[model samples]
Target: MADNTAINIENIYKKYNALLEGHFLLSSGNHTKFYLQSAKVLEYPQIAQKLALSLAALIKEHSIEVECVCSPALGGILAGYELARALGVRFIFTERVNSEMMLRRGFQVTKGEKVLICEDIITTGGSALESAQCVAQQEAKIVAFAGLANRGFCKAILPNNQKGNEGSKIQAQSPICKLPLSLPLFALANFSFDIYPADSCPLCKDSIAYKPGSRN
Candidate 1:
């Protein structure tokens, strides 16, 4: 993996500016001025390879002995595959089954395997935790986690530790913590929650055009 500190996240944003958009509802359910479309980078094999190399370098810096790299289905799969390739380790993904993420199709995390969870984004950390829980169910240890961008959100929740209250408040725990490539031009904190609901929202009442955005 390449060194995250050395990789200019700002440069990444500049390269892929055409793909990003405004007024988006993130997976974390927060509306922000900036959106990171990881797919745009992943769609380009060269960019993906560069990111994977950077992530692999970070893993090496941390001295995390990961035997395999596990990622949640859909978004994290490609990045995880690239990371595993860079590290020369096996790669697997867990898909959502009835709302609960699980490994299927004969995929299994053998007991005692040192697993590292990878994800495209780190909003809310929900999917990453699901992947971690699935691996833990097989009695494997999670060596560390890696993400392309950490969006400066406080309180990232982990899997299987929802009941506990320790270390839950701390935000951003990626081995390779890269600041968002683009900074938020505007702060939405001033906006009221009623302004952004699906319907009957205050913004709607105020005639503010609703902008629909998605990850894909």
Candidate 2:
């Protein structure tokens, strides 16, 4: 039988050696000692299903309605597809063409259609935000964001802006992710690591930092 128990995402990464401790570059143009290569754990279909199912359960607990799941292409495709399958919702992805994220392949979102953005891992949620923009351009409503793991720059559940309107921005923050604070981010676990910008990266003083994940 399939294991339906709660999963410890960190442990899974450890088991697969997906968690690495070293100076590395992130897609967000930040440097960190630790890197989570979710592909290592997700390469196994069974494990991917289990993880996706758990994420789906978390989303449903919030009573959030989603008609579709959209993920940034390349890194998020597997996790997104698995999540969509678990949620019984359709899945589509956005790809970068000429340095801009576009929704190609004849995919379409109806006006105000509810969508949930999924990612394998969210560092500063840059890619996810780009995907959200694509959905927003289609006039679809982004209900929430989900990821397998969070880098802990932001909390899993964002604060309430009950008095705010649709175009309101996150208050009291410099906007690392650029995602609105009103939209909650759901993740299985929070992986807290020290992140530094390229200019001030301490690791760059001696060791060379390499871009590990897909994205410039």
Q: Please provide, for model 1 over 1-216, each residue's C-alpha lDDT reduced to its tens digit, 9 standing for 90 to 100.
A: 354454555467558762354455555444544566677778889888877887676567546688999988888888889889989999999988777889998888889999888887665566787788899999998877667664544233222222342333433343332222221110001111111334533333434342342333
What lDDT does candidate 2 reach at residue 182?
Answer: 80
* Residue 12 lDDT (model 1): 73
lDDT of 1 at 107: 86
TM-score, each model? 0.71, 0.89
What is the per-residue lDDT of model 2 for residues 41-141, given as tens digits with 9 covering 90 to 100?
98999999998988887777678899999999889999999999999999999999998999999998999999999999987888999999999999999
Q: Which stretch of 10 consecutive residues in model 1 shows the poorest summed lDDT? A: 183-192
- Runs in model 2 deviating more than 4 A are 1-5, 158-175
Reference-based lDDT, each prediction: 0.62, 0.83
C-alpha lDDT of residue 90 in model 1: 96
Name model 1 segments beyond 4 Å from true: 1-6, 154-216
Total backbone clashes of model 2? 0
lDDT of 2 at 80: 98
